[model samples]
Target: MSAVLDIGSHKVVCLIGQQDSNMGVRIIGSGFGVSAGLKGGVVVDMDAAEVGIRTAVEKAERQAGMAIQSVSVNVSTRSLRSQQMEVHTEFASGEVADRDLTRVIESSLSELAQPEDAILHAIPLNFSVDGEDGIRDPRGMFGSKLGVDMHFVLAGIGPLRNLAHCVERCHLRIKSAHVSPYAAGLSVLTDDEKDLGVTVIDLGGGITTSAIFRDNRMVHVDAIPLGGQSITNDVARGLSTPMEAAERIKTIYGSALHGADDDYVNIPCPPMGAQDTLHHHPKSLLTSIVRSRTEEIFELLRDRMTDAGLDVYAGRRIVLTGGGAHLTGVREIAEQVFNKRVRIGRPNGVLGLPETIDGPDFAVATGILKAQFMDIDEAISGPPDLSGRRYRQRRYSGGPVGRSLQWLRDNF
Candidate 1:
């Protein structure tokens, strides 16, 4: 058995796996440990983060009874960006074979601009040749020229470097580090959602990450640097309670949408004095604090969606994942604001995991493990010198050229 470690701000997780024929990759073991030296999904300190990574890895290793060498980590930074690129090549033999297709696809990828940006993943979404469109597999398709549309997920260098250093310092080779949103999307997003359109929102403890998918690949993604912790803070400040108490209160009583009755739940309050005499209605105290902050986060998410031109989801849906996905009334709030169908998503393509980690908090870790089993590490060490090539740029028929209605239609 082999395993990979995911060092996150809230927790450090290890996913242990091995190859299987009938079931694909099977999960034999896993581990979780407290996290230190990580903030907003990036490694804030090397030594402490190394300790957390090693702790999780060793637990999984002990359980699976296998020595580990390398692992694939995840990066969930706010500075990440995504864009789709299309490259075309007239066939040398006026024929498109497997190798020729790969070449042209690589050529298009070579044209993408990632000078200061580190690519987390690049996946081909679709292929169009000549005037033909909607081709999923083009290996055997006959075409005079090959055109490929792909989605590239990129992250910042400092965040990636810090994460890599932490893993390496733990004596484990970093086989790869994928964008957390992409990883989460890979784990929770289904084929139909990806094919039609969907926005995957991962609400972690310290950060809220989002990925917009069209044509079954991630075309746009963004991360909000605030999360459930903010709610906890809001509760603490509003109620004038300790952070721990406020966190407990928020988890027990917080709701994104304001409700009608304040009698939904009763909560204990720390006494103003040393005596344990004071108590309050949990719902009453949460009056505007919890609801306001949560709504603000969703507003930020909507703004991000609008900024990325993903707000037009005529045929798309919103799929929420992560620890915050379980928050009360999130789907309801998102649907009301975005005015679209919304639902929560759980991890897919994994076996033998408890129903708890099966949720959104484990999305990225599960994706990294799945990528490792699929041997997608090569995709992480992407080509650095992508220069001097022609790519398909979006053009709007009636609107401005930068509007890209065709691109929007082709994707959404």
Candidate 2:
């Protein structure tokens, strides 16, 4: 059995799953709770975060009738970003071998200069032989020089350590950490979409993140510390309502696009201090607030892609996921802002998921569970210790090396 924890700004989710004979994950248990002590996907208060994590995990354990010792968690902080690295080496024996592959990747790691940040994922984009590019695997192939293009997802070490410490307080070890956007893409994107190029925008509660996938691998990832929570705050301040009531109103009647009848619809909002007093506001006002904030998010995301020089790579397709994706007219807004085809993406490839939790909001958690069953060859943990002699000796001992090689052959 494997477990995944999706610690978000608005909720904490725990899922326990087991792999079936067909190599698919079946969710046997799942639970979630309102999040506390988190902002923009980073843990701010240890005590409050621990309580939320523990409550979610305990509920899952009760449902699964089993306890867990470790879990793979998702990260979506604003510090999350991606970088590219390339390294090349000559083969002494004129033939590329497993050791040669390892050596090239290790060299790339050594070349990284992010002292304040740690790697969350090291995805091998493609390999090359001699002067030729786009070679997937060079093993057993004759080449005077072998090259590798690597894409690394990185995050601030300080925030990661804080997140890990908060999870540790619940007596659970973090088996691995995955970028929330990448995980969401893994669950929601189709094979053709990935191969043809697509952008996944995770519209989370407190953070909006994007992941660009092409050639069946993530090419870039970025996050901005703004999301659905900002819209809720806008409603609260605009209507003089409490936070709870504002959130309820937003969920029940929020729309990113104005409707012809919105002016006729009236929403009753309880004031902050007195629940007895109600303020009736036209739904048009609420829709205007939501539409303004929603447009800003997509505009910012478009500028981010352009600034990163990845706008061209993003293609004309976009997939929206996470809790904020549930907002009405969000897809249309994204399409208008990005000038791309937009679709609401939901979690797929998992079995036995409850209907209530089987939505785009659960994409990250479901992807985390699916990642354990994937055959891809990439490191999801922190930076590897290539300087260790033990690691060098056992790097290719298990099925991972074979699976990775096969994946490269099949995909690239």
Candidate 3:
């Protein structure tokens, strides 16, 4: 069995499951808790974050009827950045081999020189032999030179260490950590969407993150500091209501688009401090507030994509996930801003999810579970090793070669 924990700005979720004989995941246990001590997906208070993690993990353990000592966690931060580059090497034997593949990947890692940044994922998108490009695997092929296009996701070392310390304080060992948007894409994206090109936006409470996938690999990752929490704050200030009441009202009646009958619908709001006084406002006012903030988010995202030259890679499809995707008319607003086909994506391919939690909000958690069985090139941890033995071992254990060998032994 395997376990994954998704700690977001708004909530913490834990899922325990196992891979079945048919290669599908069957979820056996799940639990969640209200998140605190985290803002913008980074740990702010160690004690508070540890409490939340322990609560969620204990619930999952109770349901699964087993204690877990380690878990795969999700990481999300505004400081996360994406970089794409190409690296090349000449094969010593005039033919591509496993060592050549390892050498090229290591060279890509060496290109990064930021001391404050930590590498989260190093993905080899495609390879080239001599002058020809778009090769998936160059091993055993005759080529004097091997080249690779690599994508990397990086985050601030300070934030990552803080998060890891918090999790450790809860007495849980870290099995692995995955970026938020990357994990969401793994859970919600279709094979065709990934192959053709697609953008996945995870709209969370305190941060909004996105990942671009093409040719069955993630190409870019980016995040903004604003999210659904910002919208709730706007509602609270505009309506003179408490934060809890504003959040409740937003969840119950928020819409990103105005309706003709909105003016006829009235919503009652109690003053921030007064318990008996009530003010009645038209729904149109609420709609206006929500729509403004939601539009700003999409507009910022569009500009970022254009500035990074990633607009072309986004293709014509966009998938929206996370808690913010639940707001009414969010899909329509995304379509308007990006001028692309948009859909609200929910977690798919996993069994035994409760209806109450089976929504786009849970995409990150579900994706973390799915990633456990994927290829090594899909996600790699950093800190270069000179011997290259670690990279070779990991490739053989989790890469295509390992799976093929296992299949052969089982069938033969």
Ranking by lDDT: 2, 3, 1
Model 3 alpha-carbon miss at residue 377, Å = 2.4
**Model 2 stretches with alpha carbons more than 4 Å out:** 379-412
lDDT of 3 by residue, 1-412 (tens): 9898999888899999988778588888898877888999999988888888888899999999998888898888999999888988765445677777876787677666356777778888889999899899888788778899988887887888888888789888778888899999999999999989999999999999999998888988999999999999999998888898999999999999999999999988878775568887888989999999999999999999999998988789999999999999999999999999999999998888889778999999999998886655743553222233444454345568776675354334
Off-target runs (Cα >4 Å) in candidate 1 are: 91-93, 131-134, 140-145, 263-266, 269-282, 374-412
The C-alpha lDDT values of all candidates are 0.73, 0.87, 0.86
Q: How accurate is candidate 1 locally (lDDT)?
A: 0.73
Clashes of each: 1, 0, 0
Candidate structures ordered by TM-score, highest first: 2, 3, 1
Best by lDDT: 2
| Local accuracy of candidate 2 as per-residue lDDT tens digits, 195-307 | 99999999999999999999898999999999999999999998889999999999999999999999999999897774357779999999999999999999998998999
- lDDT of residue 244 for candidate 1: 79
